[model samples]
Target: MRYLSVLLLSLLPLLAQAVEVGERLAPWTLLDQFDQAYSLDDQTRTLLVARGMDGAKLVKEALQDRPKGYLEARHTVFVADIQRMPALIAKMFAIPAMRDYNYRVLLDRDARVATRYAGAEDKVLWLQLDNGRLVAQQEYATAAALREALEKAPH
Candidate 1:
């Protein structure tokens, strides 16, 4: 038991080091509101992650009035972690409402992917990548700030 405890303790640091810069992110695929599969690849320049409904709302407001494919054109992808939501609620209310949005929101239903990165629970995490390698990270707590950054981001 002591050996096992020691082994587990040693592994804690590795598990805690989530989403560091200068590291290549493993590729992942998730389905969007439209049930379209999107994958993280070399072409993805920016990844936007929302850990909960609040963060998702911020992204929604920020993208309001934008044309379709606005994020794709800028090589950006938005992911929303919805693992905590009940499946029945998601089907009856949440997902249907999301279909009206102009942007694609990749659903992290199980949180297996979103939990790999570290960020504030109520803030949107913006990860800048270069050919699948992480370069920088930023967190936005407001829609206006996120909108401004998105507008000025390079295509």
Candidate 2:
């Protein structure tokens, strides 16, 4: 019983940051891959948050065909959560890639923002928000499914 209690207590902080459906996302400010400032306020009418590397890769793969202008025109924001990476590695590879990358990739450095949306790692969290209020969320098992959903979603 004592061990269970301790375990539960240890998870309390994680539980506190969970983002629920139908709730407005908590305000967040993070850096883009280029190390530029990107905030929740800077997001679009529809936001797609990828929780970890797998999620980011999925999101990238799903949107492979779309050009930067198309994404910008659609008012869609793609956030890449890189909080799981070591600080040194992030500084080395992750941050530097942004300099040449065309698309915007928001780097959730501490992952606090990502944890607020999804506690798990390596899964994409598709969140559609309007004026900062969450309207929908779903987990995709395949890139094709995610692509179809994004194609069908209201822009």
Write model 1 residue lDDT over 16-68, tens digit each, in one string.
Answer: 65978999998899999989998899999999999988999899999989999
TM-score of 2: 0.80
**Model 2 off-target regions past 4 Å?**
1-10, 98-100
TM-scores of the candidates in the order shown = 0.89, 0.80
- Alpha-carbon runs more than 4 Å astray in model 1: 1-16
Error of 2 at 113 (Å): 0.9
Report every candidate's CA lDDT.
0.93, 0.72
Q: Kindly list the per-residue Cα lDDT of model 2 for residues 1-49, writing each as its tens digit.
A: 9999999999876667566667888787877776678778635666677
Name the weakest run of 10 consecutive residues (lDDT summed) in model 2: 114-123
Best TM-score goes to which candidate? Answer: 1
